[model samples]
Target chain A: MAPSRPYQPLLLRLLHGLNSIFVIGAIITGFWTYDTYDGRWGRLPLPQFKEIESIHGTFGLYALLLLPIFALYAFRRGQRRLIQPDTLAKLTQVGKPIWWYTLHRITNTVMLLALTFAVFSGKMMSEKWLPQGEFDHTWYYLHLIAWAVMILCISVHLLMSARVGGVSLLLSILDLKFRPQDSPALWSGHIRNWLSQRFKGTPK
Target chain B: MKQNLALTIIEIIVFISIIAAWIIPLLPKLEPEPNTGSLILSAPGAVWLIPVAAKQNS
Candidate 1:
């Protein structure tokens, strides 16, 4: 018999959903903006559309605003479980060549930071810089680079999550139709097993 | 632990560099332009100001 893990907090689940939607919207709208501004990146011609650019910029701003809230929640709720010495010790012995968890956290943080700057600079460029005929090539250059980096980082994050958490875990986040499994129960059972083994001083 | 520390330091450096790269351009600097164009824009030239290209001349 094993202890049952509690269900994920509703607020965290909602935030995750919102964050995922905004991120995907931002990426799509970003491509639209790129085509509108500089269409050379894509193979097919994507004409610039003012409406699309506006949508992209708006979504980007929204994501930027939501990030700190999510970060705070993650820190407050998971601080002990995520960063405990015991957890780290377990992780170090997992025998996985790649530190998937560490990389996932680092990449997500980097992407968020990059996205924040992208949105901030974009707003500044649109409101102050662009209107004044201050077409700073540097801003455009950095924005493009940031967009590329963010995309790359996100791709890597998705791949790693799928690899480590399995397809079902990844799909569960997407609200897709999948066979029901008592994931919380399973996770709690795992924790109980680990704790017992560790306490009993048995090799895992 | 050492590896994690090293990675954190590297990430911080990269983050700072990115911020600096963006902020540097925002600072005001003297940009000299040729004085050959008319200092004052006429009414039609004023229309040009509405578009991004028109402001480039100034």
Candidate 2:
């Protein structure tokens, strides 16, 4: 067979793609919610509403369920793609492309961490906390901090994705083409094999 | 060509949004009175009650 496009796995594509959408929606709507209620640090000029919290919260809820699943898949299959301190130490010794690759992995890890914390803190935060105009809440502050972290992480992620994978890698997640080998029917077997291999040498 | 154009546009929009996100948080905080008798509406984000004002940092 001809060499196919280097694509993300079908499962990762779906999970990560949807997760990306949820994260994007949640973040934008979240800004609206933050602007409408908190806006203590800064605010978007976008129109504000009270239900923005629920909208953002709904996305958060969805992410809380799926992101961990994607994380599991990533940890199992693409663990090497994750950045570690040791890997980062070699960054300066590498070429520019490798540096970009390292940066990309680091940003991806940051994105996952930021998303997890944002959702966790957000779930703990109530609209009442801000509706009553309360600003000293712990969870609320953490959520705000997560927002800034997400911004930074996403900026790096986008830049690295463009530099390393360029548009092809960025667009791959959006590609709907399915190869015969990647058919959904085969996913179950692939997942089973993956799971078996992951546990093959592990101590029970 | 078309595919590349779309991808570039997406990259630009994402880049802009990232810049906006970074900029928005650093601008300034809106000071809300602790005892304002205001029923802050949530969601349906198009609605505005009090004057819509954002503090811009120079």
Give the best candidate by TM-score: 2
> Taking the tens digit of each residue's C-alpha lDDT, what string does model 2 give over A104-148?
777776676677677667766656777789889887888889878
Supply candidate 1's per-residue lDDT for A87: 34
For model 1 chain A, where is the 10-residue window of minimal lDDT?
A78-87
Count of steric clashes across candidates, in order? 1, 10
- Cα lDDT of all candidates, in order? 0.57, 0.70
User: lDDT, candidate 1, residue A72?
Assistant: 52
Full-model lDDT, candidate 1: 0.57
Give every candidate's TM-score on chain A: 0.65, 0.87
Off by over 4 Å in 1: A1-8, A78-98, A127-136, A175-204, B1-58
Clashing pairs in 2: A39-B30, A40-B29, A41-B28, A49-B43, A50-B41, A50-B42, A50-B43, A51-B42, A51-B43, A52-B43
